[model samples]
Target chain A: MVPLSWYLALSAVLFTLGAVGVFLKRNIISMLLCLELMLNAANLAFIAFSSFFGQVEGQLFVFLVMTVAAAEAGVGLAIVIAVFRNRETLDVDESNLLKL
Target chain B: MTFEQILFILFAGIVVGGAASVLLQRNPLYSAFSLITTFVGLACLYVTLKAQFLGVVQIVVYAGAIMMLFVFVIMLLNIRDEDTAVDPNRFLVYLTIPLGAILLGALLYVVTKVNLAQPTGDEGGTVERIGTNLLTKYLLPFEATSVLILMAVVGALHLAKREKE
Candidate 1:
């Protein structure tokens, strides 16, 4: 059987990769994709702990997290659509009217 | 050495590789496709964790529904590969290298220290057990999530609605 630490290490690696992607990616949609990556990494950790502790709470939390992710995706994509409609671009740096 | 370990490595490799592709892909459509692979790999990982219900839900909700929405938006926007914008805060990209290394190291240190005794056999993960818990102990939060979903639907409808001329 694989040790719990290995699962956790993978989760850590994934989360770091997502964080770095968020920092480096210029596209708003890619940033959103990275956000989903981070969420999945967290869900992986929760499930690993749930199985390790033999508790359902962590699984339940993951359920809630999934629910939230669904909601976030809906609203986030809507915002993306609206932004693209107005700005005619999906680039985060190009939509810097607020900085002006 | 074991089947489960091999499966873990395979799925983990797919997940990590897909996620990296998602970040590296210049086209949002390609990134969305890569994200689907990542989600599917995570679903397999969930099943291996014995959370069969979540594994199914991860596929249905994330890979099926959410990713479809992503691909739909990417197509609707007609985002091409060359549309990728220049990074104004280019220095932040370099800064993330050190910060992410520190973050990963800290998380690994903390998790490696968890040496709890192996869990004795518990009730195997089942829809019945999860459903019962959802209705009994977690009913309120479950209900709240419905409201949250409703709000999201309404908000998306409003936000994406065509503005009156």
Candidate 2:
């Protein structure tokens, strides 16, 4: 056994990195990429727990998550492109039309 | 070290390195590329953890469909012509590095503290069982997801199509 804690610890690291990357990167697309990383981290934890407990529900949840991720990626990219169309910029700092 | 441990280390390196490059790269397109690497590592990890179905889905849906969507959007936006804008808060970006390390340390502490029951090995993850579970126990959510994808496709087309002024 590779130890369950190792996988959990790795998940935590990836999640934190994604969170920090969301703050560090100014581009909306980069932040979206970071979000995907975070999502993957969560998925990793789910899979780890499933394997540790020898259950099937976690894999099912992974299926739903992947479904949602696919939907989210499609819709999010569309929104990004829409915003770019209106504002002509991809940078988060530059696209602050709603800022008062 | 066991073979599983060695494989875990290899996948971990790929995941971490790919994630670092995703944020460090200048172009969003390159970030998309790095995202593919991360997904590949994640899928391998899933396989090692014995979630073979999810491992395949991670590769097929994430690395395949999601990345292609990202690349399509990157090309569609024509983001290359614009001069690369610098990150506004250089200090905070640097500060986040150590902060993230500390967070990882804290997480390691928490992980070590928890003791889960060892596997009983009664049920293993088989594709047929997953499919049965998807159809019976998770039927509602599975069907709902298909509907969600339908909505997403329609919404994406509506959102991205050039509106006639």
Candidate 3:
């Protein structure tokens, strides 16, 4: 049987990749994609733990998280589109009008 | 190794490999395609973890809906070949190596310390059990999630609508 630690390790690696992507990628859309990756990594961990403990709570939590993630994606992409319309560029460095 | 182990290995490879490609690919379209593979691998992993409902939801919400939105936006944006770039700073590029190593080290340490006792594998982790838990123990999260969805709808509309000139 595959060990739970293995799953956790994989989740951690994926999460790190996503986090790094968020920090390094300049494109707004790519950054949003990275955020989704991070959310999925967390969901993977939660389900792994729930199954390891033989409880259904974690699965239910995953469902809740999925709902939130979908909503976040919608709002985030709309913002990206709106910003692109005005700025004519999705580069993160160019989106500094709001920076204080 | 058994069939489950082999499957786990394959899915793990797909998830990690696809994610790396997503980060490394120069074309945004290619990155989006790679993200789909990552999502599919994750959905399979969810199934192996006995969260059948969650697995289906992952596929439906992430692979089916969210990814489509991503692709749509990419196409709508019409990002040309001249738009992309690899970051130029050597210092920043090198920093990722050590940072990633440290994060991986911390994760490995925590994983080693935890004692994850395997399930007795008797009771099926059924959808009925999940439904009951959502109504009972997880009612608050369930309600909060609906609110989150509502907020998302409003926020998306606000974002998409043109500001009053």
For candidate 1, lDDT tens digit of each residue in A8-89? 9889988988998888888888898899999999999999889888999888989999999999999999999999999888
List fnat, each candidate. 0.69, 0.72, 0.64
**Candidate 2 lDDT tens digits, A1-100:** 6888989988998999898888787778888889999999999998888888888898889889888988999999999999989888887777766799
For model 3 chain A, the run of ten residues with the poorest summed lDDT: A19-28
Q: What is the model-wide C-alpha lDDT for candidate 3? A: 0.84
After superposing candidate 1 on the true structure, give the runs of residues whose Cα lies further than 4 Å from its correct spot. B85-89
**Local error of candidate 3 at B131, Å?**
1.7
In order, what DockQ does each candidate have? 0.73, 0.71, 0.70
Interface RMSD of 2: 1.7
lDDT of 3 by residue, A51-84 (tens): 8888777777778878888898899889988988
> Each candidate: what lDDT?
0.88, 0.86, 0.84
What is the TM-score of candidate 2?
0.92
Least accurate 10 contiguous residues by lDDT in model 3 chain B? B81-90
Candidate 2, lDDT over the whole model: 0.86
Which candidate number would show the highest TM-score if scored against the true structure? 1
- Tens digits of per-residue lDDT, candidate 2, B66-100, equal 99988888888767434345556568778887898
Report lDDT (Cα) of residue B149, candidate 2: 97
